[model samples]
Target: MRFLDPTKIAEVAAKFMELSSPCRLCPRKCMVDRISGQIGYCGAGSLPSHSGILQHFGEEPPLVGIGGAGTIFFTHCNMQCVYCQNFQISRGECGEFVTVEELANEMLKLQLFGASNIEPVSPAHQMHLFLEALSIAARKGLDLPVVYNSSGYDSLEALKLLRGIVHVYLPDLKYADSRMSAKYSDCEDYVEVARPAIREMYDQVGDLELDSNGRAVRGLIIRHLMLPNDISGTVETMYWIRDNLSSTVAISLMAQYSPIYEAWKFPELNRRVRASEYNKVVDLCWDIGLENVFVQELESQDLCIPDFRNEKPFSWD
Candidate 1:
């Protein structure tokens, strides 16, 4: 298996700390002076802000085997999803700032705990910092897959830099329509940015590849959390995937959307997804020639979104 270059990854990490003025690392292009510790829309400075770090089983089956994905919940996010389950941390409501050296320590700590992979949640705004920590871990004999868990609103240029660095790209194509994306996440150009960014991710890692033991060694895993009553324009999203991306890409059609964060404020997402809504989208994925699919049990909703706390980041401890 091909391993990421430890030296190159370390350079990318150190390069982020050298920024003087506003950093435009993410697609938001927020010109915030992160180097001098000025906060931006992401509520983060040059260094990374982590809420928790530990093994998590709330991920997909391949990611959450006996050895769970080593998940480090990065605080703050580029996009503000209306129904975010982890809004507390994503909105900077909770977390402690950690320098690049401290961040490196956290990565190594997870490795010592027998984690299958180092998973960074909501890392779009802190890609540079993540690369630095990854480099340190790589040099320290951390030889597990590095999973880049994101919300899919990434810059194509930034994604290009992550080529060969990220083993599995697990991103949520949240919206197919720009209006819905704007209304929910305040990003009208979500589809525009996400489409090309995902393409680049697929270009780097074509299809989801599993080992003989079924652990994901490499590739892209597209997650489309079927929103309440299929109101997120999932049908169009599936069609776009079939036409744009290769049919071999594995898709996790999730139905564990529980009302959390400020979901009750929006009538469309006030409740859980009905059975018919889940089936409709699942059927569409199959009809459109999407062969590789992973469906979450409807009962998995209660087990998916755990109470956001500072102690643990995932549903499964």
Candidate 2:
């Protein structure tokens, strides 16, 4: 389950930096000239901006045990989900832009704080910068696992660039139906884009594989959040994962949907997911014979929504 060798990682980083003009990194394909600092749909220029980095304990059990997952919260996102939990960061409410060198240093700092791995959340837009930072960290001897945490709306080409580089591919399969995707995340081609992207991820790295110590070494972890009702399109998506991908892949069925962002405007997503909805999705997971499934406590809905201003990201000392 080892990822790409360090040399291969640097090579990928070098190629990624060459992309300096209008970028089409994500499915949105805004094609804005990010190299020259013009903002695109993601609201990020060529550089990487961070809301914060901390050890997050509020993740799935495998990611966060007695310690925590080293989580870097990136500002802005490719998909502007109506029920986004991290609205403060995703909506660009605040962040600090740092150089690639600074980003490398941040990785080391997280390790110093006893973080399990460097988890880059919402990193789809900053792949180039992240690659640069990764190369730097690799040189400086940052040895922890690197988690590519993202929304599934990524380009297959861009994702291929990450082959062998990313250890754990943590991506959300948000919508099973295209219409629901367009209504909530403003991406009509979400299912189309995410499906192939996930297949590529699976091709690169199969199901979850762990080290001798039980920490993940390399693999794909699919996360699906059940929306307030049946609005999340979970049933079809679950079946898709079961049928298309191997049943061995670790699937995290999340019930931590606390309405944020512009969710109030949409009646179906205005409130927390109902118990019936969560149970239904769980039942579907079992029906599909998905054994490597992770489920959150329904009460976790209240805690998963971070108090972005004060709480910082999850970490353990």
RMSD of 2: 2.0
TM-score of each: 0.94, 0.94
Give the Cα lDDT of each candidate.
0.82, 0.82
* lDDT for predicted candidate 2 compared with the true structure: 0.82
Candidate 1 stretches greater than 4 Å from native: 14-21, 313-317
Compose the digit string of candidate 1's lDDT tens values, residues 223-266: 88878856677888888888889778888898888888888899
Q: Write the per-residue lDDT of candidate 2 for residues 123-167, one digit (tens) a residue.
A: 888888887887788777787878889999988878888876787
Per-candidate count of clashing residue pairs (backbone under 3 Å): 0, 4
Give the per-residue Cα lDDT of candidate 1 at 196: 93
